[model samples]
Every structure is written in C-alpha cells, then in structure tokens.
Target: MIKDRFSDDDDGLQPLAYNMSHDEGNAANTETLHLNVLEDVHIFTTQFELTHKLNVIQKAALLLQSDTSLDDAPGLSVHEITALANETTHKWQQPWTMYLTIVVTALGAIGQGWAQTSMNGANLYFPDAFGIGSGSARDNFTVGLINSGIYLSNGLLGAWLVAPLNNAFGRRGAVFAAALVSLLSNIGGALTQNWQQLLFFRLILGCALGVISSTLNIFAAECAPAVIRGGLAVSWQMFCAFGIFVGFIANVAVYDFGSNAWRLQLAAPFLSTIPLLILIYVCPESPAWYIKNNDHYDRAFLSLCRLRNTEIQAARELYQAYLQQSTKHDSKDKLTYFKTLTELFTIPRVRRATVAAHTVMISQQLCGINTTAFYSSTIFLDANFSKYSALLASVAFGFINFVGAFPAVWTMDTLGRRSLLLLTLPLMALTMLAIGLSFSIPADSPAHFGLLAAMIYLFCAEYSPGLGPVPAAYSAEVFPLSHREIGTSSAVAVTSLWASALSLTFPTLLNTLGSQGSFTLYAALNVVAFVLVFLLVPETRMKTLDELDEVFAVPTRSFIKYQLTVYIPWWMKRYVLRRDKVELPPVEGWRTEEYQAVCQNEE
Candidate 1:
C-alpha cells in the first residue's frame, strides 16, 4: 500500500540508483547518479507538500546503497526520513561579510538621516541668520522652500539619476558617489553666505540622500540571508533614526553658537559620511547583481561563498538556483534603462509590486511624518514652551524614535509586513487624533502641553515600527532582482515627491488651519492609509526575493475570490450572488522548459 502511493507514475519519487564506486569503469554511472539525486532532491524540497508520505519515502531512497535493492534493504522509518529532510534543509552559518555589509549600509543610512533631520532643528535659527523676522509669513515660506528643495531633488534624482548609477557601478559605487556629494553639499551649505546658496547646496544634498536611501536598503536585503533579511533590511531605518537622534544632539550642542550654530549643525552630518565612504569601498558587490547583470559567474560565486559562508560547490548551486528563478521573469536580451522602467509598469506581477511599493511610500509620507519630524520643535514652541524646552522635547522624540525601531527589527520577520502595517496604522491614527484634540484645550493649561508631549512621543513610538521601516523593507523585497534597482528608486521617488509637497505646504497649513486642523488632517490620512494597506499589500516576511515574484504573479481577482470563499463567514457568503464570483484561471505553474530539460537530462 505504501509503495502504491509512491508508484512510478509519481514522477517526484522516482527510484534512484546510488553509485559510490571509485572504479574507473563506473565513473560515468557515478556522475549520472549524483546529478539525478541532486535534481530529485531539489524538486522534492521545492514542492509545497513537505509532509507527504511519498516525500519522506523519496528522502529515504536518497540514502540507499547502489548494490542493495529496496526490497532487500531495511526501509527507513518516517521519523528517520523526516530527520534527514530537516538536516538537509538546515542553513549554513552566515559569513562575516554579511554583518560587514549591514554595518556599511547602516552607515550610509545615518548619513541620509543626518541630511534629512539636520534641517528640522536648523530651521528654528535660519530666520535670525537670514535677517527675516521670527513668525513672519516670509520666513515660514522660506523655511518651507528650503526643506522642499531636498525632497524635490530626491524624487527627480533618485528615480531618474541614481538608478542608472546603481546599475552601472554596483551598490558600493553608488554609496561612494552619494557620500562624496553629501560631503561637498554639507560643506557648501555650511559656508554659504545667503539662503539662496544654502538652498542650492541643500538641493544637492537631497540628491545624494536620494541615492543613499534608494540603494542602501536594497544592498542590505541582497547581502543578508533570507532567514534574517527583513531584520537587516529594516535596520536601514534604525540607522536613520539614529542619525536623527545624532542631529538632535548636534542641535543641542551647538544651540549656543548663535549665527554660526546652524552652520555647525549642517556640517555635523559629515562625521557619519566620512567613515561610510571608506567602508563601502571595502564591501563586496551584491552576488546576485554580479551574476545577473554583469555575467561574472566566477566572481559571483566567490562573493556568494563569502556572504553565505559556504563552499564553492554549494555557492555555485545556490547561485544557479537564483539565476534560474530570475531568468523566468527577466528578458533574455539586455534591457536598457527606459525598457527596465517600462517593465516595472508593463509586467503584471511587477506592476502589482510597483503599485504596492508606490502606495506604501506615498501613504507613509501623507501620514504627516515629515511635518511632525521637521517641525516638532516649532510645534512645541507654538504650544508656549521656551526654545530650550522645545528643543529638549525634540531630543526626547528622536530618542523614542530610535528605540522604537529596535522592536521592529525583532518583530518584522515574526509579525509579517502586512500584519505590522495593519496593527500599527490604526494606533498611529488614534495617536494623531489625540494630539489634535490636545490643541483644543487652552494653550496656557499644563494639561494641554503635557498631553501634547505624551501624544507626540506615543506617535513616534507607533510610527517607527511599521510606517518607518516596513515600507522601505517591503519595497526592496517585492521587486524582481533585475528590476529591484529601478523599482526601489521609483518608490523612493514617490516618497520624495509626497515629502516635498508636505514640507512645502505644512507651514502654510499650520498657519491657516491651526494645530488642531493640521493634526486632524494627518489623523484622517492615516485612516485612509489603513484601508489601502489592508486591501492591497501582501505579506512578505521570511520569503526570498524570487519567491515573492510568484506570490504577486497570482491573479488578483482569483486571489480575492479565494479569500472571500475561504475567509468570509458563511452568513456573509450567503448574501453574495454566485454570478458575481470571479472565474479566472489558476496561477501559471513555475517550472519552465529549461528547468524541465535539466531535470530530464539528469534522469
């Protein structure tokens, strides 16, 4: 009966003859047998039904001797077969290069964070240095324009400019270029004589930030093992929070510098960038990118060995697996930049991923994070706090933001991306509502200020875990390896555009709508973000980049219909008409002709 279930018709469990002989006459047979075993093992493990009896039987067969017949040899028990499979599937220890890569990328993220948040505190003093009256409309508009310039260049340069750089020179080169620009921009900004010159330098710095932000997470994701990829990739945001924290500290340290304080604050970010430039040069190029884009198989294999802590054979096999999966979606011919960009929208799964990436980026910005981050001190100042007290509150907020990000690194893989977003979005919404409502109380009341401070801290805590890191991690994970650079660039571009709009408009909104209306608008936007994430974004935790392709390639209508049938309550299903049920073909199977040929040749 057991044999009947694993009959010859079950191609997955075909019998294999082991060839352990060292004799010259049997060398051909031994090679053929080795290839057969490798192919069968690959197919069996990749299947979904891991616990099938036939699957266990196949594993048992793999350990058999060539001279012994199945009938003569003692059959392995189910427990023994399961143990073998588990042993086979266990991952190797990650290499030191993996950790090194994480550190290098996080450093780049710190530079980006410094560039973004440095302006937040410096804006407070800009009016004094620029000779504009405090609280004047012209001063507010100028500050907004300076902040908006960074984001505007981030959108344009990240999407169109940095993408090709990533493709041309690899992640390390891109980061190096970004660091150089940041160094120059910060020095230029610090030495500027007027607001106009400072704005120009800030715009240049934004372009550098765009390159760093768009590429660093992708580099981390590509370099890490799949088991911990989410944690490592999301570490970019943690470093970003760290950078912001450092900026806040810099502001506090230089607060007494008077007119020159802002200049010191602007230049402080270079401390992070200087080390980043050197370390990035020491890091290796992404193995996946090397294999796929550059056609340097030997170098890719070596890089894989270093990154995964495995031997040459294992590295080669793994790289081949990655190449096979990628080739299924990528074109055989070389893709130009425009063609790659077009493929992001033209391909079905890619298009869905792009939509999800863009939505998450846009939603994160529209949630009013930039407004809150860039103007927290100003917000407190408006609440009747002294300048020193407001700056202290900003420092506290930055600390909370940095600490909050640590939990996501622990929970991101366990909680799943969609789950984290869903869990946090509503809480963020409520927190914003609380902050808005606090403004309704008299500004002179201690209760009003206390509630406002507490709510702002709570909001930062809630936001850092999900909205801050998950979007960047998710966007990096969702795209195909061939298009990951452009896809992530596009997502960052959307973030910058939305950030630009918010940065440019938030001051005006605060002036016109008052604190209550501004906060309420953010709260409502969070509510809408919740709905979009719930409906569209898919779970991507603990999955490899290639596996995500199949996840998104499943037809949307069919997936929705399946969800309605299986997840919806029976009572709810009864109200739905059978005519409305979507009837679509099942997902196209993953096995390609090339894979089949390889399997057949081995057999």
Candidate 2:
C-alpha cells in the first residue's frame, strides 16, 4: 500500500523535483528518492511553508532511511527539521573574486580615455605638419573633418558593430577584440607619414574606443553586487579621466622632442591597451549574459558563484531571482536587429529611459567639455600663453579632471545621481559664465589669463564629479538585461554624434564667435541642461537595475516630485547637512499605496 501511494505521489512531485534539480545539482536516482519522501511531507503542510518544510523533512528522512537498523523511517522531529531548514538557507559572504573582476574590467577605461585625449595636445602641431594653414576656409574645413572623423565613425559605425559582436563573442571577447584593434590602430598612427594615414588610423582607433566604451560599463555593472554596482561601473569613467591625465602628461613630456613628438603622443594609448588585454584574459564572462543570451544555465550559475562569493546553492537562488525579473519581457524567439531597435523605442519605460539617456549623453557633449578638452591648448594659446605654457596648462586641467573624478567614487551611491548633477550643473554654468567674462577682458591682462585657467580647471572639476561619470553609469543601469546592449550602444552613438558635431564646429565657432562668445554660448547650453535634468532625470543611486526599471515606469510628474522634494532633501539632510539636531519633515504622497502599486504593476 505504501509503495503504491509513493508511486502515485511521484507523478505530482515530478515537476518540483525537476525545478529543484535544475537549480541544485544532484544524482538522478538519489534525487528522485529524496524528492518522493519530501513530497509526502509537503502534501500535509500549509501552502506557505510547503517547500521549506519539504526540504527540512526530506533531509532528516534521508538520514533515517539510510540506516538499515531503522525498522521504518523515523517520524519527523520539528526541532531537527527547523535546524536543517535554517542551515539550507544560510548565506555565505561574497568572495574577493568579485572585487578582482571589477578592478580588472575597469582597466579598459584607461585605454578609452587615452584614445580620446591623445589628439588633444597633439593637435597644436598638426596644422603645420599636415600643411593645413590655420586661417583658410578649405584648410580649416579639412582640419575639422580630420578632428571630428573619429566621432563620426563612432556614431555611424563603431557602436553598431559592437552589438552583434557582443551578442556573438561575449563581453570579454568584445573587449579583447577592441583592445587588439586599439593596439594596431595606435601603432599605425605612430608610423603614419602623412595626414591621410593619421586620419585613417584615428578613425579606426575611434571604432575600437566606441566598442570599449559601450561594453566595459555594462560588463562591470552586470558583474558587480547591487550595493556597489554604480561605484564600480562609474570607475570606468574615473579611469578614463586618469588616462586623459596621463595623456596630457605624456604630451607635456614629449613637447620638447621636436617634430616626432606628436607621433609618440599618438602611440601612447597602446600602452594602456596592453594591460587591458592581459586583464580580459584573466576575467570571467558576465554570468547574466551567459544565462540570458546563451542559455548556458550551469555555466551561468558557476560564474555567479564566483562573482557573488557565495556557494552554488546561494548563487543559484540569486540567479533564479534575476532570471524571474529579466524573463518577464523575454520572448522565446530570437530578437532580430530591427526588432531590438524598435522595441527600445516602443516599450514605455524603456523608451522613457532611452530618451533620458540620450538627453544625458547629448548634454555631455553639448555642454562643452569636449571643446574644452580637445582645444584646451588652443584656447590657452588664443589667450596669449606660449606653446609650452598652453601644453602645460592642458596637463594641469587633465590633472584636475582626474582628481575631481575620485570624489564621485565615494559619493555616487551615498549622495545619489540626481543630487550630484543638481549640485554640479549650476556651478558648471556659473563657471562657464565666469570663463566667458574673463575672456572678454584684454588678452594681455594678468587677470584675464589667470581667471581663464582657473575657470577651466573649475569646469573640469565640476564636470568629472557629476556630468562626466553619472550619465554613463545611469545609462548602463537603466536598461533591462535584454535591451542593455542595444540601448547602451544607442546612447554611445548619440554621444558620438554630438561629440562629432561639437568637434567639427569648434574651430569654426571659435573663429566666428571668439573665446568669449563661444563660452557664453556654452554657458547657455549648460543652463538648458540643468533645467532638463531637474525636470526629467531620476535618482538611481542604491537601487538595483530591476528597481530602477520600476522607478522609471511610474508617471513623470510623481517621480520628479518624489526625487526633488522627498528624496533629495532627505539625502541632503543626512549627508550634506551633517547636523545632529536638524531633521527635515517628510513629504506627503511620496510613497503612497497608489504609487507603490503602480511601480509594482509595471515591474
């Protein structure tokens, strides 16, 4: 009778057994026997505790069933079962391997930074070497094309190329390929004998940089723990700033090397690529990517184990949680390129995020950082500094940028993204105005030169902390796992487009408007960016990617008010206020039941 009953119960338990075994590996025959006995216990338990009770009872029953001396399986003991249940669910600390992964992956950002600024100081000499006169319309046009060509390629081709490659080769493979391209491109630029060759190599180098920029942040964010994900992801931006600083120092060092100094400057980015290649080889692929895209669940689980510093069972649970959230929108059919791009704009929350991300990226370029970075030396020269002095000033600005980025690493999660941007953008606008006013003074005045340098450094300082890193981090965090690749690529493409436009028009704008007029225009753009951010951008700090998606899905009016009146003021009081006695009153309707329901429904 018991045998017949057990056989009858097996049919009911089959699905549960499969689910458990799918996540927790065990021998087929042993698993079946264990699950049969567990299912018997589960049948009698309350629905709420069925699974937990079954695990506990089955573990104790296995011990009793194993002992042949037991005439029958011993009756379940509540205390022993409870102890086993607690033991089963106990979590271990995350391992050092996860931290190591973030550190290694972030190294690629240095190469990206180097590639960007490599042309900055070197452009001072390009006009003479390429035989392009400074003042003529055709020559300036060619100069603009050569300077902006990389960004044009980056926007038009580079990030688009990375999407399919990222899907096929995995993030690590994509990074390695980008590094290899960078190595060869930098070498080619170093060996170039003519202007055409330099332009060709730089265009190719831009392609490499676009792939790295799009992939590295997503990879870091996917692998990191939620608690520190923003910090680790933005570490790429920090490293990029560090690389630009190094590039500036290299330019300063080689300025005295005469005619070949620019060649050496062009070649310096390859050094960062060498370390990037080495690190990618040693790192593991993104576990989430493996599971969602490749359907390699076991490998994904193992990768998660290493990344989370937990045992297999714990990692399995975490992976399952991620899968549940991610698979809500996943289709069984493979997504085509056109379908993916269409979906990015069609989904409401995703579309909102895409628009916000696009705005931030475009703002980064249009707010005049690229113009400041690419033409700092030129600007200093226009301000009456000697060539060496201009190069040295550029180096000083790079150092300020590098140093300024460090504070974001500490405050990104604590202060929140919205707070950082609100705090910095106003100051950035003021600094731009200060710079423009300074330039309006006589070029020979000591105050004119001193204020120009000071405001430029201040602009770099303001930029690195918020505008520089937060947008990239925010964009990387906002996308769902399914759309992350294409969505981030689109953001990068917009960045490239705006950067190209700014770079192509900068020389002409500088000539037509002069320094004071160009800077005043930038100040106005900053004011516009500040208003857009205040109205649209959400506070995404300390929230998981899944949580952020829900946050974005809420209506814009309620979300913006929650950020401005409730979240920001509370954050300010806690971190910024630093006073023991003062406590801000909470705003009503901030976390009302209706708002919570909306977020939950969207999620």
Candidate 3:
C-alpha cells in the first residue's frame, strides 16, 4: 500500500482507501508507483463501485440487529433512533409522506384507467351518432382509428417526452403538467361532436396518460423503501384497476341520460385529475431524481428524510445511492438527454435493462388484456346479450379486474416478479382458450353467456395479479438512475405502440375472425408471452436499486444456460417428481446471505 500519499494540489479532502496488491517486491512497488501517479492525476481517484455501496448498505441494515445502545449514536436524532429500532420488525410502518405520495400516484393511475375503459360504454353509442352505424368495412376502420387514437399518440409522442419533462422539471412537475393536460383532454373529448373530433381529443389524452404512467412508476419506486418498494410501485396497477371499476360505474350511471351518456362517460375522468393537481406539490420530490439530475446531495438527503421515518435511515440510503450514481460517468462530462437515450442501447448494463423492460411491456399488450379493457361491451354484445345487459357485464368485468389486483400489493414482493409472471401467463392462456371455446354453446343456452363471462373474469383475475403490476413496476426498477427516465419511457412507448396496433387491428380482426378466432389468437399470444418471460426476465425482489447492477451483470447466455441445465432439472426433480433432498444451484451473482437476511427481517 502507498501508506500516505497526497496530491500536490490537495484541498483537504482525504482519500477513502488505498488500492492494495497482494504480491510483494516488484509488483508492490509497481502498484505503489501506479497509485502515486493516479493520486497526482486526480485528488480522489479511488472510485466507488456499486458493490462497495451495497456492502456499506448491508452493514448499516445489520446495525439495527446489534446489541450496543444506539441512543447516543452520532448523527442520529431521537426519531431516527426509533425509526431504525422499528425498521426490521415493522417493515410496513413508514412515514405518512410516503403513503401520501403513493396516493397521488394512485390517482394518476385511476385517471389512466378511466381513459382506458371509459370508451367501453361509449363504443356502443358513438359509432351510430357519428354516422358509422352502417357496419360497413370503412365504418369499422373509422371506429378502430378513433378508439386507437389515444394509444397511437401515446406511443408516437407522449412516452418519448418523459425524458425531457423529467430532466427539466423533475417528477412532481412532470406529473402536474400531465394532470393539467388530462383535465383538458377529458373536457375536449366529452364535448366533441364528430368521430374525428373525438379522435383528436383522445390522442391528446394518450399523451397526458403516457407521461403520467412513465413518471409515476419511477416516482413511487424512488420514494419507497427497498423493503416494500414492490408493494408501493404496484399501487399504480391496483388503483388503475379501481379506476376501471369506477369508470364502469360512471358508464352505468350515465347510460340513461338520453344521447348525452357517452359524453358524461368521457367527462367523468376529469374529477380524478383535479385532486391530482392539488396534491402533487404537497408530496416529497423523488430523492433519486435529485441525485441523478445535478448531484444535489443535500436536497436528496432532505427529500429522503421526509420519505423515510428517520434521519439516520435517510442519511444511509442517500450516501449509498450517491456513491453508486457517482461512478456512472466522469465528473467532468456533461449529461444530455440525447446521450442518455443512446446509452440505453450502447451500455451493456443499460441494454439488458432495456431488453427486459421491452419484453415485459410488449408482452403486456400481446396478452390481450386491453382487447377486453377497450371493448368488453362489444365482446359481450357479440355473445347475444342485450345492449343494457352488455353494459352490466362490463361493470362486472371491471369489478373483477379491480378485485384481482388487490393480491399483488402483497405478492409482488413475496412471490417475486419473475415467479408471478411464470405462474400466471400459462393460466391466462388457458382462460383465453376457454373464452374462445365457450362460444360453441348455443346462444339461447344460459351456460353460453355464463361461461364466456366467467372465462373473461378469470383471465383478468390472472392478469391483474401478475402481468398488470409487473410490467410497469419491473421496468421502473430495472434501469440505473442515470438512464431510468429514458429507459422507462422507451418501455412505455413499446407498450403503447403495441396497444395501438392491437386496438386498430382488433375491430378488423373481430369482423374477420369472429369472437372465437380472435380469442384463440390471443390465447396463442399468451403462450408466447410465457416463453419470453421465462427466458429473459430475472427476479427482482428485496434488492435495492443500486444492487441490481450485480444481478443484471450476469450474461444472458449464462442465465439461459443455467435455467436449462440447472434450474429446470432441479425444479422437476424437487417439485414435479416429489424427490427429497434435491440440491439446486444458486443463481449466479445472487448474494445468498443478503437475501436470507432480508427474508428473516421480513419475518
């Protein structure tokens, strides 16, 4: 070791550690010479890696378990002392500010949910009012275009804006901007007199909703503690399901209002945006956003203190995150939006995150949940239900969708994201297949209608608990802080674009393939979703955002080979064949001790 070396132009900041070598004599002397040169080049040349930060974090968490009195611990306040004392035993206990932030995020989700399913009831009326009720080929395309306008605009324009908005204004500001736009779009859509006018408003609605979706997931994830981050992040999906349920209620309430019912349905979502605008500034800004933007370390610490229950917890996390983020780029290089966007593909770690995010987001669309979300009334009508009955069935569908997602807030952290995807994708495929086959029953039979509705409910139930929450939550958590906004925006764009394609194609597809064939096609796509998730996605539970670098660092080919050669066989022998004492290989790069400690703490 270079025992005591100092830069000639030192400004009084001491070096954290020396880079040591094991060999003695020539190697040691050479290493010392290299270190001396490095010190001369830069005062603090000993860079911090993510692993070093994780190790420090692990030690801090372990401190709560020590028997030594923390009452007099340096830099800890009374509340912070209590907070750390309760952290492991009471994981659910958190600052009210964090929960309030989650509430704001939920409202945003509700607005998007309303935007998604609000059109379900209107689809029954607007096609006729706009003079497209003739059911011709051209009319079908027009209805599809109008229905898909939001998604098309979201994919093409809004999702891409996440990076710029977030970079310039921060998460809270971006969300506030989206809420204002959402309010305007809702009013414009409600008042439109023609399909073209409605389409234009819906396109604008898509832009607002995309920004909300892209920003809030990252916002919630950043504010929440690692122990319960999954639960908080998934609130987006759970409340979105609630929004769908409430949207259906709005649809039913306004259905009897003569020809104005569709307008009322479109206008209902504006109420959710109103509160969002008022409450957004009250919530704490994301600490990660502060760290990523300008190394506003003091501000980030203050933000963390508000989000966490104690100052000590805030300080520890802030320091860990700060060190991890500092290593991403040189201190001298300036970060730009375009450079960040390109890094999503060029950097190996970022590229893997991008790939995994795209896989889940695209799979979310192809699984066909939105097909039902956007047109359940139309689907029910095709089953020979009356117009009034179709709307009622849709209300039921919306309720089931909401109820289905309630379990994920708990399971998302416990079962792990990849596990939930694997477990539910096959079930979704089976349910979609059942829905298609149910049509073979005679129209007059009660079982025909009952079975079709049951299958649809089952499909949504499976989707809500798994795919619905996983896509956005996973995408938000996987990327490094430096590229988070750009990465998540890209993933959301893929989802929106795919949703746009699905929406535009479905009406034409439904006309050509009939209900049975369309459902069957989606069933096959669910199977594809299963295979993609199984092969590409990795589990992300109970790990800090910084620590994920180590997880994704394992090569994809290695991960695949391990699954095929080790994990699959071990699983078959242990679970399927009921064998005893089967030892499975640990996933490459997972810190087993850290995971066990987390599990123990959760208990």
Cα distance off (Å), candidate 2, residue 83: 19
Off by over 4 Å in 3: 1-79, 331-333, 589-603
Give the range where candidate 1 is weakest over 10 consecutive residues by summed lDDT: 1-10
lDDT value, residue 435 of candidate 2: 93
Better of 2 and 3 by TM-score: 3
Lowest lDDT 10-residue stretch of candidate 3: 1-10
Clashing pairs in 3: none
Lowest-lDDT window of 10 residues in candidate 2?
A: 1-10
Which tens-of-lDDT digit does each residue in 433-498 have in candidate 1? Answer: 999999999989999999999999999999999999888888887897667888888998998999
Best model per TM-score: 3
lDDT for each residue of candidate 2 in 342-410, tens digit (9 for 90 to 100) = 988877788878877887887788689988888888899989999899999999998999889999988
Clash count for each candidate, listed in order shown: 0, 1, 0
Ranking by TM-score: 3, 1, 2
**lDDT of model 3 at residue 302?**
71
C-alpha local distance difference test of each model: 0.74, 0.74, 0.81
